[model samples]
Target: MLQNTVSTRRNIGGTEFPILAAALPVVANDPVGDTYWHIRLKAATTHLSSRPGQFFQLRCPRSEAGDPFLRRPMSVYAVDTNVGEIAFLYKVTGIGTTGLSTLVPGDTLDVLGPLGVGFDINPEWDHVLVVARGVGLATMGPLARALHHNGVALTAICSYRTPEATIGLEPFELHGSVHTVYDTDGTSDIASVDSLIREEHARRSFSFAYTCGSKRIVSLLQDLSSQLGFGGEVALEQRMACGLGMCHSCVIDLRRGDTVESVRVCTRGPVFSLGDIVAPEETLSWYRSCDESAI
Candidate 1:
């Protein structure tokens, strides 16, 4: 399949391109809330080796609003290879996303994608657990489906600030077990996530845990996995300008050994082994505090 594939011509920053072409229905409005939009991009390339927790970079429809020239990064929600389409779940938090929200069907939006390392799925892992919050739900959707198709057991706990913040979970239910945890207040706390994992662990020996959205939550899962003796993986989120690895905007401090090391979230991972990452406690606590401060 790689033989027929063409290297992504749109070089946003030396990244892999899952974005084949901009789909005609350029913008799709999902009332996930006044804040979020679900978009579909036409991917002409045949091989989308994208796993869960990988992300894409998107350029909003061009306009006179004088928005940032840089593309904004987003997570890959799902990929339909037979149809040659890749989907995105994004929230309109700033000028870039606001411009994206105004686009209608047939409008053109430049996108580059399927970039970054993704979650690892092992055939030996009979049971899989997914933990995510808000828009983070988009990052893990495809993995759940892939695992289901492979006959691996799946369970998910997706959290949102309120009922309106939830979408795209129905697809998860169709494939495997799904449980929603709607936070009335937008806390995105580790306590709730910890509770969910504990509840699930009591029932069965989950082989692996997949997480996305908040770094704090990822760190928490990593800690919980260690305590429970289950392996874990995390999809990280960081503010990015170039979706590719060229820019160092998304560098993260990782533990390589006794020393803390830097890893780029764009290329090295949107996904990382929970065990391999270093400084989980301090780094994630800072990140979660910032997230709460933003709200």
Candidate 2:
């Protein structure tokens, strides 16, 4: 049976707690290419109970004169209960992320979180596949850790624009098998990723598949899951001005039976079952036009 690590009635997605956190030392901050950063922050006791796949809205300290007015939504990379700390892995995408990279130890940040519904891992599944690209790997770390602790076998594939862009592979390797893929340099490609998923599915017959990345990749995995006769879940990446449900900006169209309805990604999920979602063609086009290096 799946251990109930979180309470269903706790309103994990609805409740938002504002917290003032102090920056801890960086775990790994590589400023080459796309600039991968892994930052840690001291958290309150309540925040320490964060589950995998949940995220936080972080307001970076103001710059000298002008700064971003809105907080950035970041995935909960990992939570260290022992130290009362939470971590986030992010790429320097815009002003918000660039500001986050500049923080030194003891810097304070306004954070609101442990929000959104997280991945629901079935305990019955003996083995599962986790597919992620770019910074999406950050969201999967905590889920992988939970699965490892539960003795569930994991096969993870992390893809990046280049080898230098990859971050936080050690934790996944420690928990289960890992496969890395990159673009342009020919280290790996979409075909290789598909091949790995096929091979793993054929060999172990994955109990489920979990993925977070570009809409293109998520769509591919969703199709693969259907073809392989296994259920899958996807964590979406969307622009959010508000981490709460009040902002309809993050709404996604979901398919329910024969009809489609809109749902808030922030409140309902950053994570959703593949079967429950309907990705618009425009989203796929946007993903194709985007620079692979851009997070």
Candidate 3:
């Protein structure tokens, strides 16, 4: 266990809290669907305060393939602040996660943070749409719980390789309705998801469209939000050596008015304002603009 570990206080967006390096007991580690593992940890009360969209850097145990050099970042699937539990959904891919998948109920794992800013829930938002695909389905649970707690209505669009591969439906369904789209059935295509989102929005206008798991889906939401006049947010996936912002490895450009500025995904966001994001097609121009500024 990460017993009696010292926590360092860091000021983030003006709030100072201890960033814990806790060794939490693994309460459960089991597969969800055929694609993902659902791991539950018995957390300290301080650790349970993580919000939806926040992630932790879990130190994976060494396995047959050898040591994973860095901790793996996984988004919070659920957090019960009162119950002292936290959960994560992740797939066993590559060296790190393969080791993660080997964990059992009796083990203790080292973890850091409730790192980075999480999704900002607008309590006034009456209706929200969440789009997720594959393992991204795991990232939606806590967000669903939060929206449900706020009495906000929700619609979740889950895309997967097959119907049986779908994950996280229970938490989302407990909070609101869920729509599954399958690649095996061609319903996971952008065009099909676009149509589905439009039909659902028409039935009940969404105040916000939030997405993770697919960039194409994020683009569709960005376009639709503009056309439909609703707010939008998106979670981005990036490879990180350090889950903290200090590494400069996970910096991404974000638009602030006419200027584009770099921000760390591990700190400023893994969740960004969909409207404020610099489009992928404009990346070259942003680099050029940065060059011109330097010159």
Candidate 4:
């Protein structure tokens, strides 16, 4: 029996709150690759009610000349109601993230969230599958926790660019079984992720699959879900100029019946049903190019 949490209807998209940086951001150095950081913030109980797959639009401290005005959209990694805190896991990939990395304990940040629709957790699901790559794991963590709390069995597959780049494995293990794959090693060839999904389905089918990662991985899972007869959801990544519905900057094509409609990623999603998403040809080509370059 899945136990539903309190409704967060009042707290959904467009809610803004002031959050205090609870501690100095912690950076984990990957011996073989780039560094990843985790940041926690003191938040109100209202803010802590965020659901899995939801994200925040964080306005970090301004630059020396007060430039880079837009807030950065970050996935909610975990929410701790007990401590009244919410956290995010991110890599310093650009100027905005770099500024976030410089934050110290007690720093104040303007947080606009828990924005976007979160993953839908149904009471009927018994077995669930979660797939993520690299920092995408951050977005999947809350869903894993929610499933565990609701007594649903979980199987998580995480892919990293290198073995050393993997972080936060222990927490996922605490919730359920996990398989880690690295691209640099021969491990990638041992058994493709799709094969594992097929194996799992043969053993005991999953009721639903949730994934957040590269477009290629998401597309693969979407195809697999259709083939195996299971529902699937994906959290998409896109560039955003505004965290609200006002900006069409983060629009993606979504299939509604026979027609494809462009929808804003910030408001309508960062999360969507696999069947509803329509991948553009250019995006597919870009994903293919990335794969080719990696090979």
For residues 94-191, what per-residue lDDT tens digits would candidate 1 score against the true structure?
77887787777666666655567777788778888987777777777888888888888988887777777677696579887887776675334567
Q: Of the pair 2 and 4, which is ahead by TM-score?
A: 2
Q: What's model 1's lDDT at 152?
A: 85
lDDT of 1 at 76: 76
Poorest lDDT segment (10 consecutive residues) of candidate 3 = 286-295
Supply the global lDDT for candidate 1. 0.70
In candidate 4, the residue pairs with backbone N, CA or C atoms under 3 Å apart (3 or more residues apart, or in different chains) clash, namely none
The C-alpha stretches of model 4 lying farther than 4 A from their native spots are: 1-34, 63-66, 189-191, 282-295
Tens-digit lDDT string for candidate 4 (133-159): 788888988898899888888888888
Give candidate 4's whole-model lDDT.
0.72
For all the candidates, what are their Cα RMSDs to the real structure?
Answer: 4.6, 5.6, 5.0, 6.2
TM-scores for the candidates: 0.84, 0.85, 0.92, 0.84
Residue by residue across 1-295, what tens digits does model 3's lDDT show?
6655445545345776666788899999998766589899999766787878888889998988679999989998888766678988898888999898899998998998878777879899999999987787677788999999999999998887777776778888899998888878788878888899899989999999888735567668889999988998877767787987768887777889999888888888888889877876665432223312100
lDDT of each: 0.70, 0.75, 0.81, 0.72
Ranking of all candidate structures by their lDDT, best first: 3, 2, 4, 1
In angstroms, give how far residue 90 of model 2 lies from its true place.
1.4
The candidate maximizing TM-score is 3
